[model samples]
Target: MKIILSNASSDPIYIQIVNQIRQSILSGELRAGDSLPSIRQLAKDLQVSVITTKRAYEELEKEKLIDSVVGKGCFVSGANKDFIREQRMTRLEEKMVEIIRESKELSMSKQDVLDYLNLLYEEEHTP
Candidate 1:
Protein backbone atom coordinates (compact mmCIF):
# COMPACT_ATOMS: atom_id res chain seq x y z
CA MET A 1 0.00 0.00 0.00
CA LYS A 2 1.24 3.48 -0.87
CA ILE A 3 0.07 6.71 0.70
CA ILE A 4 1.47 10.17 0.07
CA LEU A 5 1.01 12.88 2.69
CA SER A 6 0.47 16.45 1.51
CA ASN A 7 1.17 19.07 4.14
CA ALA A 8 -0.33 21.82 1.96
CA SER A 9 -3.61 20.00 1.34
CA SER A 10 -6.78 21.29 2.97
CA ASP A 11 -7.86 17.77 3.96
CA PRO A 12 -6.66 16.17 7.14
CA ILE A 13 -4.27 13.23 7.09
CA TYR A 14 -6.87 10.79 8.39
CA ILE A 15 -9.33 11.83 5.69
CA GLN A 16 -6.69 11.54 3.00
CA ILE A 17 -5.80 8.05 4.19
CA VAL A 18 -9.44 7.05 4.27
CA ASN A 19 -10.12 8.38 0.76
CA GLN A 20 -7.07 6.72 -0.76
CA ILE A 21 -7.85 3.34 0.78
CA ARG A 22 -11.45 3.57 -0.34
CA GLN A 23 -10.33 4.41 -3.87
CA SER A 24 -7.91 1.50 -3.85
CA ILE A 25 -10.65 -0.88 -2.80
CA LEU A 26 -13.04 0.46 -5.44
CA SER A 27 -10.38 0.15 -8.13
CA GLY A 28 -9.74 -3.51 -7.23
CA GLU A 29 -6.25 -2.77 -6.03
CA LEU A 30 -7.34 -3.92 -2.59
CA ARG A 31 -9.95 -6.61 -3.12
CA ALA A 32 -12.18 -8.35 -0.63
CA GLY A 33 -10.37 -10.51 1.95
CA ASP A 34 -7.15 -8.57 1.31
CA SER A 35 -5.52 -7.95 4.66
CA LEU A 36 -4.56 -4.38 5.45
CA PRO A 37 -1.52 -3.55 7.51
CA SER A 38 -2.12 -3.25 11.23
CA ILE A 39 -2.77 0.22 12.60
CA ARG A 40 0.62 0.56 14.25
CA GLN A 41 2.38 -0.79 11.19
CA LEU A 42 0.55 1.51 8.81
CA ALA A 43 1.21 4.49 11.10
CA LYS A 44 4.92 3.73 11.13
CA ASP A 45 4.99 3.17 7.40
CA LEU A 46 3.16 6.42 6.68
CA GLN A 47 5.10 8.33 9.36
CA VAL A 48 1.77 9.41 10.81
CA SER A 49 0.38 9.13 14.31
CA VAL A 50 -1.27 5.88 15.38
CA ILE A 51 -4.47 7.73 16.16
CA THR A 52 -4.72 9.07 12.61
CA THR A 53 -4.33 5.60 11.08
CA LYS A 54 -6.80 4.18 13.57
CA ARG A 55 -9.31 6.87 12.73
CA ALA A 56 -8.97 6.13 9.02
CA TYR A 57 -9.53 2.44 9.61
CA GLU A 58 -12.45 3.19 11.89
CA GLU A 59 -14.07 5.33 9.22
CA LEU A 60 -13.65 2.57 6.65
CA GLU A 61 -15.26 0.11 9.04
CA LYS A 62 -18.08 2.54 9.71
CA GLU A 63 -18.69 2.77 5.95
CA LYS A 64 -18.86 -1.02 5.76
CA LEU A 65 -15.96 -1.01 3.29
CA ILE A 66 -13.75 -3.12 5.49
CA ASP A 67 -14.07 -5.63 8.32
CA SER A 68 -11.92 -6.51 11.30
CA VAL A 69 -11.70 -10.01 12.66
CA VAL A 70 -10.63 -10.81 16.21
CA GLY A 71 -6.96 -11.92 16.22
CA LYS A 72 -6.82 -11.11 12.50
CA GLY A 73 -6.22 -7.91 10.59
CA CYS A 74 -8.70 -5.73 8.76
CA PHE A 75 -9.77 -6.97 5.34
CA VAL A 76 -11.71 -5.32 2.54
CA SER A 77 -15.39 -6.26 2.79
CA GLY A 78 -17.15 -8.14 0.01
CA ALA A 79 -19.90 -5.64 -0.53
CA ASN A 80 -22.79 -6.17 -2.94
CA LYS A 81 -22.72 -4.29 -6.27
CA ASP A 82 -25.83 -2.28 -5.52
CA PHE A 83 -24.50 -1.26 -2.13
CA ILE A 84 -21.23 -0.14 -3.65
CA ARG A 85 -22.99 1.76 -6.41
CA GLU A 86 -25.24 3.52 -3.93
CA GLN A 87 -22.30 4.42 -1.71
CA ARG A 88 -20.41 5.80 -4.71
CA MET A 89 -23.40 7.82 -5.86
CA THR A 90 -23.82 9.30 -2.39
CA ARG A 91 -20.18 10.29 -2.28
CA LEU A 92 -20.35 11.78 -5.79
CA GLU A 93 -23.34 13.88 -4.82
CA GLU A 94 -21.51 15.25 -1.81
CA LYS A 95 -18.50 16.19 -3.95
CA MET A 96 -20.72 17.70 -6.63
CA VAL A 97 -22.41 19.87 -4.00
CA GLU A 98 -19.05 21.19 -2.89
CA ILE A 99 -18.05 21.99 -6.46
CA ILE A 100 -21.34 23.77 -7.07
CA ARG A 101 -20.89 25.87 -3.97
CA GLU A 102 -17.38 26.80 -5.03
CA SER A 103 -18.56 27.72 -8.50
CA LYS A 104 -21.27 29.95 -7.05
CA GLU A 105 -18.72 31.65 -4.84
CA LEU A 106 -16.57 32.31 -7.89
CA SER A 107 -19.56 33.74 -9.78
CA MET A 108 -19.15 31.16 -12.51
CA SER A 109 -22.23 30.63 -14.65
CA LYS A 110 -23.91 27.24 -14.89
CA GLN A 111 -23.06 26.96 -18.58
CA ASP A 112 -19.42 27.77 -17.87
CA VAL A 113 -19.28 25.07 -15.22
CA LEU A 114 -20.99 22.54 -17.46
CA ASP A 115 -18.66 23.32 -20.34
CA TYR A 116 -15.58 22.92 -18.16
CA LEU A 117 -16.90 19.68 -16.74
CA ASN A 118 -17.58 18.34 -20.22
CA LEU A 119 -14.07 19.21 -21.28
CA LEU A 120 -12.68 17.45 -18.25
CA TYR A 121 -14.82 14.39 -18.98
CA GLU A 122 -13.61 14.25 -22.56
CA GLU A 123 -9.98 14.63 -21.50
CA GLU A 124 -10.30 11.82 -18.99
CA HIS A 125 -12.38 9.52 -21.18
CA THR A 126 -10.42 9.95 -24.38
CA PRO A 127 -7.59 7.54 -25.17
Candidate 2:
Protein backbone atom coordinates (compact mmCIF):
# COMPACT_ATOMS: atom_id res chain seq x y z
CA MET A 1 0.00 0.00 0.00
CA LYS A 2 1.12 3.56 -0.70
CA ILE A 3 0.44 6.60 1.48
CA ILE A 4 1.44 10.21 1.22
CA LEU A 5 1.47 12.80 3.99
CA SER A 6 0.37 16.42 3.70
CA ASN A 7 1.67 18.53 6.54
CA ALA A 8 0.08 21.59 4.97
CA SER A 9 -3.40 20.09 4.85
CA SER A 10 -5.94 20.98 7.49
CA ASP A 11 -6.82 17.32 8.01
CA PRO A 12 -5.08 15.45 10.78
CA ILE A 13 -2.24 13.17 9.71
CA TYR A 14 -3.84 10.01 10.94
CA ILE A 15 -7.11 10.80 9.16
CA GLN A 16 -5.24 11.37 5.93
CA ILE A 17 -3.57 7.98 6.26
CA VAL A 18 -6.82 6.24 7.05
CA ASN A 19 -8.75 7.85 4.20
CA GLN A 20 -6.04 7.02 1.66
CA ILE A 21 -5.89 3.42 2.78
CA ARG A 22 -9.66 3.19 2.68
CA GLN A 23 -9.68 4.61 -0.82
CA SER A 24 -7.09 2.08 -1.90
CA ILE A 25 -9.21 -0.76 -0.62
CA LEU A 26 -12.29 0.54 -2.45
CA SER A 27 -10.34 1.12 -5.66
CA GLY A 28 -9.02 -2.48 -5.65
CA GLU A 29 -5.48 -1.25 -5.26
CA LEU A 30 -5.30 -3.10 -1.98
CA ARG A 31 -7.05 -6.43 -2.23
CA ALA A 32 -8.91 -8.23 0.49
CA GLY A 33 -6.54 -10.39 2.56
CA ASP A 34 -3.58 -8.18 1.64
CA SER A 35 -1.39 -7.57 4.62
CA LEU A 36 -0.69 -4.03 5.70
CA PRO A 37 2.68 -2.72 6.81
CA SER A 38 3.30 -2.99 10.52
CA ILE A 39 2.48 0.10 12.54
CA ARG A 40 6.09 0.71 13.46
CA GLN A 41 7.23 0.28 9.86
CA LEU A 42 4.50 2.50 8.48
CA ALA A 43 5.24 5.12 11.10
CA LYS A 44 8.92 5.05 10.19
CA ASP A 45 8.15 5.26 6.47
CA LEU A 46 5.56 8.03 6.85
CA GLN A 47 7.56 9.83 9.53
CA VAL A 48 4.47 10.13 11.72
CA SER A 49 3.87 9.27 15.33
CA VAL A 50 3.28 5.59 16.14
CA ILE A 51 0.15 6.63 18.00
CA THR A 52 -1.24 8.21 14.88
CA THR A 53 -0.77 5.13 12.73
CA LYS A 54 -2.02 2.88 15.48
CA ARG A 55 -5.14 4.98 15.93
CA ALA A 56 -5.80 4.86 12.21
CA TYR A 57 -5.38 1.11 12.11
CA GLU A 58 -7.56 0.68 15.17
CA GLU A 59 -10.30 2.77 13.61
CA LEU A 60 -10.11 0.68 10.45
CA GLU A 61 -10.42 -2.47 12.51
CA LYS A 62 -13.41 -1.03 14.32
CA GLU A 63 -15.05 -0.39 10.99
CA LYS A 64 -14.33 -3.99 9.95
CA LEU A 65 -12.40 -2.78 6.92
CA ILE A 66 -9.31 -4.52 8.25
CA ASP A 67 -8.62 -7.29 10.73
CA SER A 68 -5.67 -7.68 13.09
CA VAL A 69 -4.41 -11.14 13.93
CA VAL A 70 -2.29 -11.80 16.95
CA GLY A 71 1.34 -12.48 15.95
CA LYS A 72 0.38 -12.05 12.34
CA GLY A 73 -0.35 -8.49 11.15
CA CYS A 74 -3.24 -6.40 10.00
CA PHE A 75 -4.87 -7.46 6.76
CA VAL A 76 -7.66 -6.08 4.66
CA SER A 77 -11.01 -7.61 5.56
CA GLY A 78 -12.78 -9.82 3.05
CA ALA A 79 -15.64 -7.37 2.85
CA ASN A 80 -18.27 -7.66 0.14
CA LYS A 81 -17.42 -5.61 -2.94
CA ASP A 82 -20.93 -4.18 -3.33
CA PHE A 83 -20.96 -3.07 0.27
CA ILE A 84 -17.55 -1.48 -0.06
CA ARG A 85 -18.56 0.28 -3.24
CA GLU A 86 -21.70 1.70 -1.68
CA GLN A 87 -19.83 2.88 1.39
CA ARG A 88 -17.13 4.47 -0.73
CA MET A 89 -19.68 6.29 -2.86
CA THR A 90 -21.48 7.62 0.17
CA ARG A 91 -18.26 9.00 1.58
CA LEU A 92 -17.35 10.52 -1.76
CA GLU A 93 -20.73 12.23 -1.99
CA GLU A 94 -20.33 13.72 1.46
CA LYS A 95 -16.93 15.10 0.61
CA MET A 96 -18.24 16.45 -2.68
CA VAL A 97 -21.01 18.28 -0.81
CA GLU A 98 -18.40 19.88 1.41
CA ILE A 99 -16.47 20.98 -1.67
CA ILE A 100 -19.60 22.41 -3.24
CA ARG A 101 -20.31 24.39 -0.11
CA GLU A 102 -16.78 25.74 -0.10
CA SER A 103 -17.07 26.70 -3.73
CA LYS A 104 -20.32 28.52 -3.04
CA GLU A 105 -18.65 30.38 -0.21
CA LEU A 106 -16.00 31.46 -2.69
CA SER A 107 -18.79 32.71 -4.98
CA MET A 108 -17.86 30.41 -7.86
CA SER A 109 -20.54 30.23 -10.55
CA LYS A 110 -22.05 26.90 -11.60
CA GLN A 111 -20.21 26.95 -14.91
CA ASP A 112 -17.01 27.88 -13.15
CA VAL A 113 -17.45 25.04 -10.70
CA LEU A 114 -18.08 22.60 -13.52
CA ASP A 115 -15.01 23.82 -15.38
CA TYR A 116 -12.89 23.55 -12.26
CA LEU A 117 -14.21 20.04 -11.62
CA ASN A 118 -13.46 18.99 -15.17
CA LEU A 119 -9.96 20.33 -14.75
CA LEU A 120 -9.58 18.33 -11.56
CA TYR A 121 -10.85 15.18 -13.31
CA GLU A 122 -8.38 15.66 -16.14
CA GLU A 123 -5.55 16.20 -13.70
CA GLU A 124 -6.40 13.06 -11.78
CA HIS A 125 -6.65 10.97 -14.94
CA THR A 126 -3.54 12.39 -16.52
CA PRO A 127 -0.79 9.83 -17.18
Each candidate's TM vs. the true structure? 0.80, 0.72
Model 1 over residues 83-108: C-alpha lDDT tens digits? 97698899899999999999999999
After TM-score superposition, the amount by which residue 18's alpha carbon in candidate 1 deviates from its true location, in angstroms, is 1.0
Candidate 2 lowest-lDDT run of ten: 79-88
RMSD of each: 2.8, 2.9
lDDT of 2 by residue, 1-127 (tens): 7798898999999989989998898888999899999999999999989999999999888767899998999999998878777876897899999989999999999899999999999999999
Candidate 2: C-alpha lDDT: 0.91
Backbone-clash count (model 2) = 0
Shift of residue 115 alpha carbon in model 2, Å: 2.4
User: Ten consecutive residues with minimal summed lDDT in candidate 1?
Assistant: 79-88
